[model samples]
Target: MKKHQATAFLLLLLAALVCFFAGREFLTMHEEEAVYPSPHLTIKKRLSDYFPGLKNSPGDSSVYIFEGQKMGGTLLILGGTHPNEPAGFITAVLLVENLEVTQGKVIIVPRANNSGFMHSDPQEGNPQRYSLSTPGGPRWFRYGSRLTNPIHQWPDSVLYVNPAGQKLSGTESRNLNRSYPGRKHGKLTEKIAYAIMQVIDNEKADLAVDLHEAAPEYPVINAIVFHENSAELAAVTLMTLQMEGVDIRLEASPPNLRGLSHREWGDFAKTRAVLLETANTSHGRLKGRPSATLIINGKDKNYMKAAQLGLLFVPFDEDGISLKQRVSRHLASLRALVSGLHELHPDLCIQLDNLPNPIEVQKVGIGPYLTPSK
Candidate 1:
């Protein structure tokens, strides 16, 4: 009888130890990563500044503004809408750290879904964070979930009706992308969405871009999704991107898609809404084991095999698309988009300086453009 008790106690102790260490590792994700914005940054604000209800809330994301000495139109860049898509988030960070607008104002939200970064997608086995080589040292960024952390807003409903009255699974309630022109007294995710809309209206934004990524198997993998209002701008940008050697397609925002940024941002606000997507093997279903290396290097044998079988929409060879390549596509499209905007709205020409060169970025990798963390 004594032996049995001893054995049980030992097992309990081992379980407790495992829980303790696992809990500690999980807690570290809550500590947000630091970002150093552009030297030309005019001011820094928070989502709460636009919506006081978001103050001190997890949804209160940081907003960076860079204004040129000369007056012109405004552009808003939203990143980290889906934290699992690192390319979008990293592109926003690069712009924040290296961009300089010389004619118009630019606003950036590097982490649009602040609560999303506090957690990773459950059961996908994604790493909590990944590292990139910088001139000074390694800089780390978190890989967050596609939805808001349940901790921030718990007890999800069985069905979710977004601000636009689109019915979605309750799980999508946490998806910031699905929450459009959010509700003032809605859930945490909704509040974040609402705050973003406020920025568009309050700042008189002329163009708004949301950065994102998709699996190679996805049909919309390497595409520019634009609202009806932005059709002309997207067409011009698509041609320019092709000229720059970037194979991209244009996907019009479906009118029935009620709550997405490209759809709702256009219907609700005067700003032209657009979203950019790049292929990421790390985010694909066929990806082998999820790890920091897979997220950074983006090489996956499974994807290559699938591509050979004609399963993927984008070409996936042994030289799997690296983070550098994905980011370069985004930058190229951005430059084209901005130029297109100038052509469409002559008065709203947003001349930018110090934007990363897409071709050069693809050649050297993402490290050089980023400022090393202290």
Candidate 2:
């Protein structure tokens, strides 16, 4: 009897110890990464500023505004909509750190779905954090889930019907990208989506760009998705990118695909909406042993094999697609988009300076562009 009691006590103690360490690691996700804005940053507001319903909620996120000396048009850049896609979020971070607007306003929401950053996807062997070396020091950012944390919004419905009335799988209820023009009193993810639309509407944005990434095997990899309203602009941008030797494909947003930012933002907010996608091997099913190194360096022998088998969308080789290359693609596309927008409407031209060169960024890496942590 005494031996049984001793064994039970030992088991309990081991369990408590395990919980203690795991809990601490989990809570660290709440600590956000540091982002240093440029001299042109005019205002920093919370998403709640646009939607009062989001006040004091985990769904609330930061909005950085940079108004140029000469007022012209407003462009909104949304990143981290799917927290697992590091390239999108990192590209936004680069803009905040180094961009200088000279003719119009630029609004950036680095973490579009704040709650998504609080936890990684369950049952996926994903790293909780990844670090990058900056000029000042090493900086760490969260490696988060694609959906909102269940703690902030509980009990997914068997079928999620978005505001657009599109039926999606239950887990999609937590997907911010699928909750466009969201409800004032809906789920947390929906509320976050609603706040973004509020930002677009209230700000009277001329152009809104959402950045994202997909698995290497995804058909839409290395593509630009644009709304019908932005067809001409997209075509011009595509031509410019091709001229620069950046072989990019353009995908028009399907009118029937409801709830997507590219579709709904243009329809409801009257903004020229566009979305960019890049290849991310770490997020693919064929990936081997997900790790921070894979997220950063993006090299995998398995992916190489897949590419050789002609199963992958983007060209892949032993060199792989590093985060720097992915970020460079996004930055290059944005530059082309802005130039195209300017060409289309001269009066609404938004002149930006000190934008990182894609080739330079690819060669020097992401560290130099990132601000040093103070």
The backbone clash count of each candidate, in order, is 0, 0
> Which stretch of 10 consecutive residues in model 1 shows the poorest summed lDDT?
30-39
TM, every model: 0.96, 0.97
Poorly placed runs, candidate 2 (over 4 Å): 1-10
Best by lDDT: 2
lDDT of 2: 0.94
CA lDDT of every candidate: 0.93, 0.94
For residues 1-374, could you state the per-residue lDDT of candidate 1 as single tens digits?
69999999999999999999999998998988879988899999999999999999989989999999888889999999999999999999999999998899999999999999999888999999999999999999999998999999987999998999999999999999999989999999999999999999999999999999999999997999999999999999999888878899999999998899999899999689999999998899999999999988889999999999999999889989889999988889889999999888888988889999999999898999999997
Off by over 4 Å in 1: 1-16
Global Cα RMSD, each model: 1.7, 1.3
Pull out the clashing pairs in model 1: none
lDDT accuracy of residue 22 in candidate 2: 92
Error (Å) of candidate 1 at residue 192 is 0.3
